[model samples]
Target: MFSDRFDQLVQALRILPSVGPKSAQRMALHMIMKNREGAIGLAQALTEATDHIHECTICHSLTEDDVCHICSSHERDDELLCVVESPADVMAIEQSGSFRGKYHVLGGHLSPLDGIGPEEIGIPYLIQRLSQGKVKEVILATNATVEGQATAHYLVEASKHLPLHITRIAQGVPQGGELEYVDSHTLSQAVHNRMRMK
Candidate 1:
């Protein structure tokens, strides 16, 4: 129905997550017809970001420099290291304002079925970093999924020799969640990890 260039633009837009053919077509039309300047700016920004952004050498988080701002900041506690699965997780933790510790992004969790293992997610490097004795505590903040739990357990086993105090992030019902709506696994975890309040 449209020109080759328009179809190409729609296809390009469809590359974004959750965007289908119709949505991509709508986006393409909106960009070309209503938001040409905004579209151009978006294109330039995407190009610049892709060119500049890279993994931080220290923690494997996304950054424009060798080390991310969080890893380089002296204000954060060096003794507390939070291990996460991705840069997005790091962003989530930062937004929560609950933690003031260093981070280690594993890039991904263990998935043996997908051939992802310890080496693939830089587990060895994490152990090496922990072995240096700078971090007194290591918080396993990976997702609560099976893969994430396995990765956390593997890290615990690997670092058993070290004198570090390792802990997993609590998993359970959300702040506004009701018991009836929660899943069995989550409810079980909530019960098992119940805190004693005096």
Candidate 2:
């Protein structure tokens, strides 16, 4: 219904997650008609980012350098390592302003059905890093999904022989969530993890 370039742009925009054909078409039209300058900047930024950004050699987080800022920061606790599923998780944790340690990104969780295993996610390499004896404690910050739990369990089993202390992040209801609206499993977990006020 549009020019070849316009159709191609719409198609490309549709490749973004959760973007439908109509939304993609709207975005293409808006960019071309109202935001051509911003669109050019966006295109240039995407090109530059794709050309320079890469996985950090130490933590596997996205960085323009060989090692990410988090990994290279001497102020961060090297003895306390937080293991996460992805760079996005790392970003979330960083924004929380709570944790003050280094991180090890797993790249992904273990999904047997999907053929994602320990080696596929570089779990063995994680174990190797833990075995270096510098890190004393590891906090598992993977998501609370079944696959995430399975991956955490696998890590626990794999590191059983090591002297490092392993801990899973507590799961419970969100801060503003009401009990009636919360799922039974999360409520149960919240009850189970309830703290004493004495």
Candidate 3:
């Protein structure tokens, strides 16, 4: 219920996840009235980030370079690879300071209803990477949701013949919990106490 420009701004704001129409409208108004400078800065940052950030060629994580920092780091353990649903999960695990290994982001979990299967989430690519023989262990760090569990199990089955040790992050994270919302301590514990999935 506003001018075309205002409505357009609200709609743009609504593109953010979980932002409803009303919340978007409120945000638009707040930015226009109370924080125009911040809004401009945010706009510039968003444009720059969107223009420059691309997926890391190796791990599929958001990065401005061909390889992400974690993937290029020499100090990190190359033999240990952590599989996660998204780059956000990688950030969560990094913040925990419990894992010093490389990562493979699946982008999403398998959801048959959504028609997202192994091929859609790059499972074959992961298997190809595993086949290189540099990695010795893989940690399944997907969320605790049913879809996450199913995806992890599928990965286990898909890589059964590979000469690699597969493990799932242990309990501590509540059922249905996503890594992004979990505390550092809990995530650290989960990483430290992971269980074999074989």
> lDDT of each model, Cα atoms only?
0.94, 0.95, 0.95
Off by over 4 Å in 1: none
Model 1 lDDT tens row, 65-170: 9999999999999999999999999999999999999999999999999999899999999999998989999999999888889999999999999999999888
The 10-residue segment of model 1 with minimum total lDDT is 1-10
Clash count (model 3, backbone only) = 0
Estimate, for each residue in 43-138, the C-alpha lDDT of model 3 and write its tens digit: 999999999999999999999999999999999999999999999999999999999999999999999999998999999999999999999999
**What's the TM for model 1?**
0.98
Candidate 2 shows a clash count of 0
The TM-scores of all predictions, comma-separated, are 0.98, 0.98, 0.83
Off by over 4 Å in 2: none
Q: Which scores greater on TM-score, model 1 or model 3?
A: 1
TM-score of 2: 0.98
Between the candidate structures 1 and 2, which one is better when assessed by lDDT? 2
